[model samples]
Target: MNLSLCMIVKNEAATLHKCLSSVANVVDEMVILDTGSSDRTPEIAKSYGAKVHHFRWNNNFSTARNEALKYVKGNWVLVLDADETLTPEIVPQIYSVIQREEYLLINLLRQEVGAEQSPYSLVSRLFRRHPEIQFSRPYHALIDDSVATILAKEPKWQIGYLQGVAILHKGYQKSAIAQGNKYAKAQAAMEQFLAAHPYDAYVCSKLGALYVTTGKINEGIELLKRGVRTSEENYEILYELHYHLGIAYSRLQNPKQASLHYQAAIKLPIYPILKLGAYNNIGNLLKEAGDLKTARKAYEAALKIDDNFAAGHYNLGMTLKAMGLFTDAIACYQKAIKLNPRYAEAYQNLGVVQLKVGNHQASLIAFKNAIALHQEQNPEEAQRLRQGLQEMGLL
Candidate 1:
């Protein structure tokens, strides 16, 4: 059972070596399609024994990926990117996976690495070489339709999930986006895709997300709403549309509409992290609306899903403090601190709650700890803490 590694890259010279080196010893063959790189990327890949081929950029990921498929010599294909590296610990198990006859495709968990907030997403990148199994969707190219087509033709075809196999992706970070013209290119590609696929709910949702990220709140809200109405059958897109719509409305200061969309997102069978975000944001909006009881319930709902979620604990603490429940608020804050020792905001809030309960010494200590943590990283916040301490006659 031979596994061929396929990748399409352009101007990824900086991190290409790390990516290629990570999987060079594992795969049977490496086939890289370079989309006009003006760097040493091709040479670096070739140095690692990759059969590098030059391809013209067409603003379509599926196009390049399909072209690369023609060069794969192995029976099984593992599609990856120049910014991603497979986990070294699971490299040995990949060979056995390629030999499995029951499944037509295998799904791996791709985890974002070196980002402030890393999230894991299931992606179908490993599969048997078949002419019918190709990539689709312009901006965020996917093989869902192709996979469905293959499975329809072969009734016994199955998709298996590899639990331990994972890839670390660094290309999706803000710093990486700013390093190249990638964001601009992606925005343009999304707009182009939307023009051709006007009624495509998935494209609309993706474009709407890009608009939100680029700060076009009104436009994002309109597109997201369209996506929601057009994508009733697509639960994935509907979840995203409602979640992003809630965020856009929150930005517009329309808490009522925001809460409605957030609640809608929460009801969807989406990822737990996304559901947690919806619950937390809904709690924030309700708290701002002076609905302390409901806000507390929302926070509790978030915590029930993950008790170690420090943000949920901190948010509940804030709501409790606003309701004049100082002791309970302090307890929540302490739990947040226990979950995350470096939570400066949690410590600051704890100090405030402690001061309210007439524990000046403990309050001063908490404030000092908070100040020490934020002094260099957040000078403004540290100064504000100092002023708070002076007012309390503790400094």
Candidate 2:
């Protein structure tokens, strides 16, 4: 089956080449709709043999998406973004999956990068190109309903999940945020969506999450609660709602409530990354409450899932140090540094522990390394480390 790779972009020159090069040979056709890019984006697209069409900036994602869809000539359309990449390993799998006419739509795992542990979710991006199969919503647009409509008409049409296939999403990287006001634009779009869909669980969840991102804690809590209430059979939404509620409660300094919600989210059969986060957070809360034993157990549980988690090891080290287990704490800190060499806080804490045990030379080396890593990233910590060295007469 010939696949058409469709995308809408504007001023995406920095990421356009990476995205196009990843799937250039995989797709049969490339339909790129440029929404007024003053950069070399259109030229770059043309260089890649993409059918680049100019589109006006309409403040609507779905509008641009639908316009791009009109130029797709292939039977199968694979929607992607400028910051998204289709891995080489998944190319043949995507081809094979779409070749089968049994499924009208395929949901691929979209892995969000730029985090210590990347989280993934099943997203609908591959589908048959039918005239009625158009995108909806102004922003955070989707065609799930269109696919559902097609499935309703043709009852035999199935939705397939391609295993071991993922789309690497780099849209959430810091560079993207620094270059644009995507968060603010998305927040406004969510508000527009929520105005009509007052009880929509998904939109409520999205808006709540946006509010949390923008530091509107109370509003986030209220909307997340509404999302939880309205979310009927979606365990995924429930898990997210509970998880965010746990975070909001933590921010509010209500550790007991935070722990309760974290436990609630942990009880659900969700993603392991989320479960690991819950365990790690629960440990932090327990540690804050002066329960070193329980906190140790929580960190142990997190390590059980992912033993190589650097933060988990560093946090466990802190708990051990608090409990006066210097040897164990040192081991944990060493393991954390082994996993993540750039962990400045782990180095700083290791120095503190070494200083406590009267290992002046080792403490001095660790503090110096921490200062080197922290100088630009954390000036306050760098100053404190310098002061510590001066006090020890090692400066």
Candidate 3:
């Protein structure tokens, strides 16, 4: 049950220590392969007692990752990123699975953190270190290709998804400039890879996402739409494609098309965040269309699926408030606050509802809370709140 921690890192000085510290005690050995880091990344890895290897910056992620794999002497390897860390719960789960000889591949859930976070099921953060499990492609490298081959031919190796471990991904932290640069490099590599493998739907879909992130809206939408058309059977890509299309259309103010795509997105087995987002968007569109009842229904449906869904609650409250259902709206806003106490939009909505219902003192408190939260996240929003309060003579 020897577990080796394998990682690929670059200029990750800020987050490298936290990532290493999270899983330092869990693995038998730590192997870090640096792709020409110019920062204190390698030094941090060494400080954490990780055996560091410097590799030339190759555009292909799989190549560097496979090279890191070569240094892993343990029976099982846990692949991680410099921006990711394993949770304490996942450590014991990997150990338990490694104690058994039946399982060859185990998939863990990767939860991306921060304000705009989402979760996805990912494989091979933990798996057997067999020579047959070679990674593939440039970006978003996967070991599943070889594992699938083994499963197809041998039919003896066990493949299962483990709920015990979750990878906390912090790649999208507040450092927008650094994150954008990483994406720029990835986009360049992906473009070169796509030139050789043009029909790769996964790569195309990722490229679309990158374009959308970089504000190339029309190009991103077109790429995503093409990806969906080519891989119609691939529900996963279709889900993402439809979701992003809705986003692009919404930005264009084409509510009709946005609603259609949003509806299509929810039909696929995507993550909860996507599902909730679709629901929220649909509700918003319906509200804008003057279909208040349907909007309420959509929001309620989202809440039924995930009670702690803060956006759903906030949107529902907004809809209810617009319809003059002040008490019900307040309840929804309160529920949103319970789920996410730091939700500034919910507090603002709650304040507005309270003011409408003549609860000036409670409204003032809610407005102040909203202002405090918004000041940290968005000063412009805080200014708007202050303006509203001043207009009401509450400031």
Candidate 4:
């Protein structure tokens, strides 16, 4: 089957080449829709022999996506954003799955690069090139609605997902959001769409989470609760709704409600990899409540799903340390540092644990590494650590 890589980009010259390079050998063709790029994004696309089409920016993702779809000549289409790339491990799986006739759409699991908590999510990036398949929603443009319509008309077509992570997306990282006014852009687009689609589960989930993060806890809670009450049983949406509700309640200092929402989120039958955040958050709540044993179990469950999750390892370490298991805490902290070398908090805690165990040399080294990392990521943390160490005659 001929596979086409379809994408909508604007001023993405910095990342377009890397994104395209990852899939160029795997995809039969590349179709890039440039949304008025001032940079060399179009030139970069053409360098890879990609058919580049210009679309005037209208702040509507679905329209741009549909325009890009019009040019896909292959039997299957793989959608990706500029900040995302196909993993080398998934290329063989993609080739294998696209040849199967029973699958109409395949949701690829994506690893959120640099995200500590919920490191994995499923995205409908790969699908058959059906004429009826058009993206919907203005912000998080999705073809799920169109795909659902097609499936209802043709019941034989089945939606399936890859078991392993197929893509790595950096767009959801805090650094990305902090740059490019991305948070503002996302909020404006979703808010506009939510005005019309007041009951849309996807938008409500996305916007509610945004609101909670932006300190509009009450607004976010209202929308998320509305989403749960009105939206159909989309497990992914439901999981996000409850997860964000947990966050909102946690921010409001209501651990009882937070734990309840987190537990509800975890009970959803979505992929365990996608529920890492819920597990981690619930563990944090449990830890704060002095339920160290339960918190340890929660972190263990998260680690069971994704052993490479550094945050899970770090949280487990914290719980172990709180339970006076210093040796195990040190091991868990070391594992977290191995998985994510820049994990400053892990280093900081490791230092504390090492100091507790009378390993003065190791503790000093850990503190130095933690201080260096915190200097770049959190200056206030670095300052506090310096002051504490100085008071203790260690710095």
For this target, which candidate reaches the highest TM-score against the unseen true structure?
A: 4
What's the lDDT for residue 227 in model 2?
92
Candidate with better lDDT, 2 vs 4: 4
Worst 10 residues of 4 by lDDT: 113-122
Superior by TM-score: candidate 1 or candidate 3: 3
Task: Please say which candidate is ahead in TM-score: 1 or 2.
Answer: 2
lDDT of 3 by residue, 1-395 (tens): 78899989888898888888988889889999999889999999999899999899778889999999999999998888877888887766777888887788887777655535223434466789898888887888888778878888878889766663378776666674375577878798888888897766777788887787778888888887888878757666677777778877877789999999989988887544446667877888999998999999998888886676677788888888889899999999999899879989899889888988999999999999999999998999999879977986899
Q: What C-alpha lDDT values do all the predictions have?
A: 0.84, 0.85, 0.81, 0.93
Residues 1-395, model 4: lDDT tens digits? 99999999999988988999999899999999999999999999999999999989898999999999999999999999999999999888889999999999999999998974578889999999998999998888999999999999999999999878899999878878787787788899999988988888888899998899889999999999999987678999999999999999999999999999999999999888899999999999999999999999999999998899999999999999999999999999999999999999999999999999999999999999999999999999999999999999998
Find the candidate with the highest lDDT and give its number.
Answer: 4
**Clash pairs, model 4 backbone:** none
> Which parts of model 3 are misplaced by more than 4 Å?
99-102, 115-124, 177-180, 269-274, 338-341
lDDT value for candidate 1?
Answer: 0.84
Q: List the residue pairs that clash in candidate 2.
A: none
What lDDT does candidate 3 reach at residue 54?
Answer: 87
Q: Write the per-residue lDDT of candidate 2 for residues 1-395, one digit (tens) a residue.
A: 78999999999999999999998899999999999999999999999999999899889899999999999999999999998999788877887888797888887877666543324556789998887899988877888868868878889888887765469887776667656888889988889878988998878877897787779999999999999999987776787788788888988999989999889888987546547767888899999999999999999998987787788999999999999999899899989999878889899889989988999888878888899989967888899879877886888
- The C-alpha local distance difference test score for the whole of candidate 2 amounts to 0.85
Candidates in order, TM-scores: namely 0.77, 0.86, 0.87, 0.98
The parts of candidate 2 lying over 4 Å away from their true place are 116-118, 162-165, 271-274, 300-310, 323-341, 353-366
